[model samples]
Target: MNTPSNRPAKGKNRAKLDPVYDLETRERALALVSHGRSLNSVSKQTGISRAAIRQWQVRIEPISRTSKCSRPDDLATYSYLLGLYLGDGCLSRHPRGGYVLRIACADAWPGLITACRDAILRVRPANSVYLVPKQGCVMVTGHSRHWPCLFPQHGPGKKHERHIALEPWQQQIVDAHPWELIRGLIHSDGCRITNWTTRMVNGERKRYEYPRYFFTNASDDIVRLYTDTLDSLGVEWRTARQSRRAQNVSVARRASVALMDAHVGPKY
Candidate 1:
């Protein structure tokens, strides 16, 4: 039998190119190509690819250029390690290669954390690129840069979020991982945080600050932190709309309460 090699193979373009792009750029490139920009024009202008530009505009969806990583014999570790490291920043501390996962769609639906977990199971990481769940998406990015500079950059002509966000859950994750999302989205919800409280401090409106943290389906910490922090600051906030599902049944009781006796009001 021929001897097997133990070394990891190199990428197609093995040089350490900057790994700072997010899904928004890809969508912007797609839109540009769809609007009649040529691949060469896109390349000269955006620095991605003639091929990628072509793929975006093609009538048939073309193949993805990003490489996927897998272990021939060690399939378990990277996959097993991804979740643990995601929480503790184990992989982010590496000397090289990490990635950001930014998910986008044309539909009017909000993504569930289950969708994120599913995507992670499907995509493979590249040489230096690895997949870790970034709140609602799995990040496949390089580790050299902190997350703040990684994905979902804010700027004019960038890909925009078409759907209303998932609320304080997304806010918490963005706080912890600024690179995971554009700061614009974080600030969008800033209004809610402040609006929930009218409690003035020193004659000025008190501001609610979001603590930095990552969001995950596996944990409630993000939600807990958000609600707790807001409550501690005396901000009058409620859980997300989805969270309101449980409260819906009792919501009708507001009218019913008026029909009950005050001394023996229906117990909550």
Candidate 2:
């Protein structure tokens, strides 16, 4: 009888062979390639072919090199970056690998944006900085895996909504470069301005003006850190009237204003 043999027909096996990969696998594989891994290496790790990895990279915008983890040695600059991150910075996972650090600075203060860019570059020399404009603010972004290591407070919610605390090592850095840290915090969410009010004295109406520094944030933890840092510097700060959106820490006392001016000047 013409029964089937143990082996299939010559072309039958080839016809039955289907694609071994799915969309998610292809994306992940391509992402690995984008993170500076060679096609051969990714193929070995994922069982994907080198040709397919190359095709995926060509199809999409290529991911840059994998970010190296390098702790910043510049104490001043590192502390400043930390404070900035605590105020208005965020870290997001890169599709391919590593992470992206973004800090929002107002358009009115272009120099702050430059400072953020410079600070990031100081730590991660291999990555490029990007300034993306949104309405009234500019987002300064750079890619690196070291950012989270530097700022462990990075997490899933707004700074005020989360439990933000400084590690002992981070606290030591801030203690050494308190001014830089304050500068970053003020640049992000605080401002120095002239506050004016009308008062009646001796049956006469008078207008009085005072220079004060105001730090507004939703996170009580961050505000506490701010006050604590100020205390360390022997500069007094008090909790001002609270609003629905944010809480205020005011440095309106004459001596305090002068002290802050010495450390954190206006965002010019």
Candidate 3:
């Protein structure tokens, strides 16, 4: 019975396979490292090698929200941020070299304003995020060098006039978190509300109410994307009449509203 067991010799070298991680998991681990977690500690907790952790942290070092190289990890959060940017986000460059990012959310929906602020804080923690009230909307503004990295759609002209298209990575992120993207779009340039009207029933005037979601954007492509997203979610939508310069799309119907409510509710 002293015959060799099915095992390698004590001092023999064995091949090691590198770990494969999905984008979300990789982002989470890198985020932990950015938040001042020691590489060894993160490696121990995440079961990832310290060397790999170090490399991940280093890869996003320049575009990190924190000086320590921590970037936002949640896919939904980034997708929401992108939606806010595409809807009413703006970027301004500083004379010193960095950039300022601002997204306008209606003050009526304070929750959305808070959400925007939180999103910026999660990505660019160092920058002071604040609200600037303009007309009926509140602008969530912050400064960061890597904002363009997140919203590559930044350009000189308005979104509608420009050729706004999502990149492969961004498309992947949106595909993974379509609801969040929809939430951002609605929060920025859309609304979910109950419309009411009066009708004659049995020779008597009666009032009826229905819930509908309206998304108004000047960009046809953006509207197409919005409708496409609704189709993917199996929600019904149709084009609504709006100004000649703007395109309006509406999602109305009991079942469709119910489905949308599951993923996106009115911004409080």
- On lDDT, the leading prediction is 2
What is the alpha-carbon lDDT of model 3 when measured against the actual structure?
Answer: 0.80
Better of 1 and 3 by TM-score: 3
| Leading candidate by TM-score | 2
- When 2 and 3 are scored with TM-score, the better candidate is 2
lDDT on C-alpha atoms for all candidate structures? 0.34, 0.83, 0.80
* Residue lDDT tens for model 2, 47-154: 767877777777654332333345577889999988899889999877655578999999999888889999988867777899899999999999865678888898
How many collisions per candidate? 17, 1, 0
Model 1, C-alpha of 175: deviation from truth (Å): 32
Residue 227 in model 1: lDDT: 42
Instruction: Please report the TM-score between candidate 2 and the true structure.
Output: 0.74
Clashing pairs in 3: none
Task: Estimate the TM-score of every prediction.
Answer: 0.22, 0.74, 0.71
Error of 2 at 108 (Å): 0.8
Ranking by TM-score: 2, 3, 1
